[model samples]
Target: MKSRRFMQPLTSPIHFHTAMIEQTPVAVFLGQEMIGSGKIVQITDYIVKIGNEFYVRDACTFKYAV
Candidate 1:
């Protein structure tokens, strides 16, 4: 018989990078609500998503900026 182990996420919500359009509001969903109705801002920050599961990077490993 073989055994396997499953890893868990460090956080409940996951964040990712987003792009900004010209004179357009950012479109994203939080739970069931939509964010950014009529605000135009630079897309320098990352987009966060909530999920049941997530993955965490190792501390010993080096992370590259995408």
Candidate 2:
């Protein structure tokens, strides 16, 4: 007998523009690993401030966090 695996639905990346507008807490992930979590405090053209750390807006992925 063969085993079947379930696949998850694909989701879109959370853009900085949307995040800035929503102003919600997010989990910061580099690839599949979560590096940090915090609420967005500020945003610039190429950077985002989450808590006390600044990350290049495009270098990491952001997802809504509890």
Candidate 3:
């Protein structure tokens, strides 16, 4: 049997960078499915704040500049 160890994010969210600014509306995706769209307000190491909610980068599938 193999032992499983807990792992954390490779990098800190503080280092995350976003080329866009707050309120820059963008489409959200989860794989081929379009989840929805929201104005980008914040960017963390792993998550993005859209409108007033936050979403994980790994979850979103696609984003189109709008």
Candidate 4:
């Protein structure tokens, strides 16, 4: 006799991204206006730093491709 195993189609990271995008609509609210919308990279209890990996990807996108 042998035991069976199951594999999940969606991984944890996928679920996390789905939740982040669906549950919370990203936006910066200013009075009655919405300013911005984007993905969240990091979060903290007391404080958080703001930034994006655009610079990093820009540096590597075609550095050695050409």
- Per-model TM-score versus the true fold: 0.26, 0.63, 0.57, 0.29
Per-candidate Cα RMSD to the true structure, in Å, reads: 14.7, 8.0, 11.8, 16.7
Q: Pick the candidate with the highest TM-score.
A: 2
Candidate 2 vs. true structure, TM-score: 0.63
Query: Can you list the residue pairs that collide in candidate 3?
Result: 13-45, 29-61
**Comparing candidate 2 with candidate 3, which one achieves the higher lDDT?**
2
Decoy 4 TM-score against native: 0.29
Candidate 2 clashing pairs, residues 3+ apart or interchain: none
lDDT of each: 0.24, 0.63, 0.53, 0.30
Evaluated at residue 2, the lDDT of candidate 1 is 22
lDDT tens per residue, model 3, 1-66: 321311122133332333243333466667766666656677765777766777788776435344
User: In candidate 2, where is summed lDDT lowest over 10 consecutive residues?
Assistant: 2-11
Clashes of each: 0, 0, 2, 0
Over 1-66, each residue of candidate 4 has an lDDT whose tens digit, in order, gives 321211111123443255345543233333444333344354333221123522221111111000
Of 1 and 2, the candidate ranking higher by lDDT: 2
Deviation in angstroms for 32 in model 2?
0.7
Query: What is candidate 1's lDDT per residue for 1-66, written digit by digit as tens?
Result: 321211111122121222123232223333444332332232222322222212122211111111
